[model samples]
Target: MQTNDAFSFLMAWAAAPFRIGSVTPSSATLSALMTKEVGPDTGPVLELGPGTGPFTRALIEKGVRENDLTLIEADSDFAAMLTKRFPAARIFEMDATGLRHMALYNGPVLGAAISGLPFRLISPRRTRLILEGVFANLRPGASLYQFTLGLRCPIDQTLLDQLDLRATRIGHTLLNFPPATVYRISRIPVTKSYDWRYA
Candidate 1:
């Protein structure tokens, strides 16, 4: 990450720590881990709370085309910076909870959804709403990767069951400021399809 990116993240956190999440930008290791499952062949991707574009940069390095990426940043300053930094990608200045309303996002079925949002700080209801919005626009088997400072998964288990989704601990990095772990959430695979041929 660049010095300006770090400075912008710090300033944004200083203003609203809850919204900005981390006091420092994510470490390179964490960024790489968060986007490990995504690649050029992974199809279009969606990113939430791309504060300073750490993960965004990592995604590009992983072979994801800039034009195929959609970034949602609630903070206007960060969103503007991301727009300039990733001119080819579509950037939206809107809350994650309101993602369902974005016309650009509603059209495409995402291959992956990477989140830098602070789920620990958000209420369970809001978290459910955001996840619902993301999954609604994602293709079957597409994964949502999220990094959290907490030890356990940030999202509730009940919500996972309700959505028929499953979570896997993909990676953890002690190199980040406070240490972070990445979780991959995806719909449970269907074992069989029912038919009435015998009946």
Candidate 2:
């Protein structure tokens, strides 16, 4: 999609009265807003709230096959748009918090989670709960890629502290609306959480 389309998409989302924070598409920030962790080449990939498929397009451009990607969006309007936009992708009309409830064991091991959800206003508890579900289901070496407006980190630090997850600032891209920074989150050293994948 073009930059103008991105702007229009964000504007519509902004007007939705949804909890979604920014409607701005950070296509330019897609690459920078990702962790260098999730190895390229292959693995089942999950994208949260892929508004207008901005990062979804970038992920395909970065070598992730359309079939290997799963696009999840809670917005019915946006979900319908994604279904038409990327016929090759698997679009889920659901919220990120309820991901674990969805049965997805038939695909490749989850290697990465690229979240564009409005996490700034989201509480750390809810964020941790969602991440816990994602992490528990991920494979070893899997990574969570999140873009944030604040140039500081991907997910909030206070949330990180509460979840016992450690995040490293991989990179940042200022070309996006309000700009953003990407962070890689993983279990800090060793934390008992029934999943070694996050460790």
Per-model TM values vs. the true structure = 0.93, 0.82
lDDT of each residue in 1-199, candidate 2, tens digit only: 4766676676676776345677666655555456345435747788888877777777787778888788888878778888988999888898788875665665337878888877777777777777877777667767788777786664667777877777877777767677777877766666546777876
Clashes of each: 0, 1
In model 1, state the lDDT of residue 159: 84
lDDT of 1 at 20: 85
Report the C-alpha lDDT of model 1 over 119-159, residue by residue, as the tens digit. 98999889888988898889887999999996799888988
Stretches of candidate 1 exceeding 4 Å from the true structure: 103-108, 191-199
Displacement of the residue 12 alpha carbon in candidate 1, Å? 0.7
